[model samples]
Target: MTIAEQYEYWQDVRKGLSRRSVLRAGVFGAAAVAAGPMLLGRPAYADTPGSAVVPFGRHLAFGNDPATQMRVGWQVPSAVANPVLRVGTSPTDLSQTVQAEIRNLRSDYGTGAPLEQYYGHAALDKLSPDTTYYYAVGHEGLEAASGPVNSFTTGPAGSGSGLKPFTFTAMGDQGASAQAALENAQITAQNPVFHLLAGDICYADPNGQGKLTDSYNPAVWDGYLKQIEPVAQSVPWMVATGNHDMEAWYSPNGYGGHAKRLDLPTNGPANCPSVYAFTYGNVAVLSLDANDVSYEIPANKDYSGGAQTSWLERTLADLRAKPTIDFIIVFFHHCAYAVTTSHVSDGGVREKWAPLFDKYNVDLVINGHNHMYERTDPIRGGKPTRTAGVGDTVSPVTDGTTYIVAGGGGASLYSLPSNGPESYAGNVKDASGVAAGYFGAGGKVTEAVDWSRVRYRGHNLLAVDVKPAAPGGTATLTVRGISVEGAKAGTEIDRITITRTASTVDTPAFGSGALLTGAALAAGAGYAGYAAWRKHRSGLDVPAS
Candidate 1:
């Protein structure tokens, strides 16, 4: 049967496959009968390899991905021999020839499981953005779910204008290693193009009490693994390191990196493994590291000038040079601006980069050091509203930028600031610094920015979408919070409609840069003359593997 067929069949009898089909399918067929497990889920890697443990307690998220690129992740055993991961375009067939690879990098840092524990990660690249493909990991055909049959899609490069709408999920603090990671992964199974782990991913704290026991181990109870099975099985799961994730260790592996290991897309941002960037439609996303081992400052100072800064400057310059790159977003473990007593806007994010951000005009900033979700309307140099104080009329800051501290991703809950919302922020800075010449140089203050919002508390996920302006229309930015008030329900915490009569063919190719490559890639990539097709909102389907 085709993958779609398998998906359809599973959808039909997925719940009863175990009770009804197990006896009918015989051994291998009985294993296929795991449609129940397929729909419901699995046992953890903690059990002996393939011990009929039924990895349960997990949920499928970000699965059946629909982007041109997709990332599949899941955990297996340290003892499970010849663990080969294979992927393809359907539930029934899994072929490596479909354009995929496998890796078995281990980790010594984590929570829940004991020491010497290892987790598995495989990052698939060069996929057709915005298309769905099925995958699984294991020896060709065994007597069960080698791992799982999941689906995913790469983020769409965009519509006719190389513009695509993308979605990413947020979660944090997987303190229990594979289990916690898995639990969050289960939630991430929603097939987000990627994820935002506010803090404490992998929980591989080499110095922590449980680091040696459970957090670093593979899976003591499979609960989380099963939970995250869906997300890990598909979609790129991005992480923001908290204090707990930075566990130093002596790895027999080359560079002697930290205790934890991540499988990132080597296909992206040449030579930059952990820190990289990608584009989805008009949004350019840059992911960076913020922890000590990542930054390597024993002083444990925050956001010091590091490789990340250099990369950010260069990346932002490149992005600004191209106007087709409508929006800019930066994600790191520590918040550039935070009201949480637990953390604050580090100098690195403030002094070093915020200026460059102002110079380049960054769109939105997302961070997760604090375990809460807060949204800033738009502010330059910390605090909200450029007016320099609260009670300012809400006027969208065209020159300034918006900030979001969305850290709540189902690990643990956090409290509000001691000073409350209005007071949680530092006294407003030079408002005109937000609006070009408004703030005079001589250590002066001018112009006042309006319209900045902030929110804190609750375990939640952020849903962001990138849509183009109407035919000859203006740019609009929309952000939605899927959970708040203790995961109550999704709410529209922030929304803004930006109008700009700026450059339309603002991309480097069409502008002054390599016009030839731009035109050629545009024509060949199926986006040439795409502006005509821009009137419609539906995304153009593309190939992916």
Candidate 2:
């Protein structure tokens, strides 16, 4: 089935499942499923040369410093003896050995299928910055041959110093599918130094709202990791949490499963893996858990007790204050500004965080959850600024932050309203000036937004190139939306260049010039051009608190 149809099907199935699905314990209830023979004991794999336990789901992540700290994660089917990773500069000589920590997760609380999963992780520290290292993972009896050792080079240390140019990929809502695999391969082709999954990474949970009744399968995560291993094993795969990530059976906030499977930077709040920040080259990448303040998905709202928001304030301030960090890119799940009907813009995000983005002059805000590719013009104070549209360059310092809904990361494709043709080439803006539906403020709003820059209904991802400014020169960030599937695969559907000067922050007056009048907006003139597409306000149900 198509992704949109699949989403609707899952929505219906979740409704049916919710009627009977009840959590016996929180997300950390590993005991919810009685320990079976496999759960309590290790499985014996034949010791033959090829019979050794095969390691799958090999992926990479980084600590606060990408140059010095690296994290290698993998999975084994069952308990293994002395799981560990060996690394060195040469593939033949793995001189350094680090023991792996196994985190086991048992899933049987609500879903009929009960199973146990083991995630192995190893953290390599004190490494040289900007150096390449080869690595292999295995235990006593079973090891993948040393002939093809996986390897990744560390990024340059900190920001500010003259560093080589670098690129990174960003997307969200990547589930297990051939389309997702295609996107993965295309991303690897881009040769990005790191990749950011804004959120909704691997939709293992059928009911994506993170509600108590959602059904989650822990095994799907295994498939997802293996699915992306081709690229993830080489590039640093950074992830944020989405509504679907909240597995209700695992822990109170439904992130127990995530805690067990992945190891992220510890710079943020105590146990929130979904929220953190890291800087590489000239850019500071910040990942946020939109579920904490998602109007689109309120299941885990405020799960961080205001700490995440408070922390974001401090982090944004620091990034803005740092001389080396020329650009700040914040990524999360729900869109702060989107022009789709399926899951439109989230007002809660705008209410709580958009101001901070404006306050700090954030360069870009990337998000997912809409299952399509879309972008907004430079925005501040809840509307589009003078600078917006394709090929139109704007400095966030004077205009505002540009928001991208790069949700087309291999889930189903969501279509734009029938009011305008899909944007591409020179057709950057909606021809009919239709006010796309936006989900926020505990309801939906149809506003004729001049900020709708590029909207494409396709499966794609965003690759950003960060070029640090030289002394007395300006820095530039180039963002590309690449089509990864269907007839238009490999086409550059959207592109934008943002320039920044050496000055850290530049504040400008709000609502500068020819702004959409409040009267025209209130009279719904924004919806006039496409009256056929303007449906009455519906499907804006306030989620159960």
How many clashing residue pairs, candidate 2? 5
Tens-digit lDDT string for candidate 2 (228-317): 998888899999988778765455566767887898898998656779998888788999998888766677777788999888887876
- Per-candidate clashes come to 58, 5
Compose the digit string of candidate 1's lDDT tens values, residues 1-545: 22123334434444455545534322234333331122122322333544432222211222122243444444443434344446666777776733222233333221233333334334455667667777655532332236556666656644333455456666555454322443343344344666655556544343322111212323332444454545654555665445554322222111122212344433223333445666665666766655422221222332223555666666776665454555677777666655554454454456566676665557777777567766655675554544312232222324466667777654565554433442222332322122211111133222322332444466556666555553344555555554534234444443333323223453433323443333233234333333222212113222221
lDDT of 2: 0.74
TM-score of 1: 0.64
Task: Tell me each candidate's RMSD, in Å, in order.
Answer: 16.3, 11.6
- Off by more than 4 A, model 2: 1-51, 109-113, 144-148, 158-161, 426-429, 503-545
- Please report how far candidate 1 places residue 141 from its true position, in Å: 7.3
C-alpha RMSD between model 1 and the true structure:
16.3
